[model samples]
Target: MKSVHMDVHALLDAGVIERRAAGFILPYDAVHVDFFLKAG
Candidate 1:
């Protein structure tokens, strides 16, 4: 889960994805991530 977060964060830092397009949540000891990308 940590690795996933790191990957997403890297994309955000690199401007590959918008801030609103990436996020994560933990529910019931689980990691949940949701990302939205603009369509061409």
Candidate 2:
């Protein structure tokens, strides 16, 4: 879970996905969040 969060954070910082208040929400055409989870 921590790794997923870290990956999501990195993605957001890299402009891969848009940041959100509740959680790491992906952009309209961005890849699925599952990618991040599995990446972790």
- Model 1 global lDDT (CA atoms, 0 to 1): 0.64
Tens digits of per-residue lDDT for model 2, 1-40: 9998898788788888776788666667646555334553
Q: Number of the top candidate by lDDT?
A: 2
Q: What is candidate 1's lDDT per residue for 1-40, written digit by digit as tens?
A: 9998899888667656555435543223554569899999
- Which portions of model 1 miss their true places by more than 4 Å? 21-40
Worst 10 residues of 2 by lDDT: 31-40
TM-score against truth, every candidate: 0.46, 0.48
- Evaluate model 1: give its TM-score: 0.46
> Can you list the residue pairs that collide in candidate 1?
none
- Top candidate when judged by TM-score against the true structure: 2
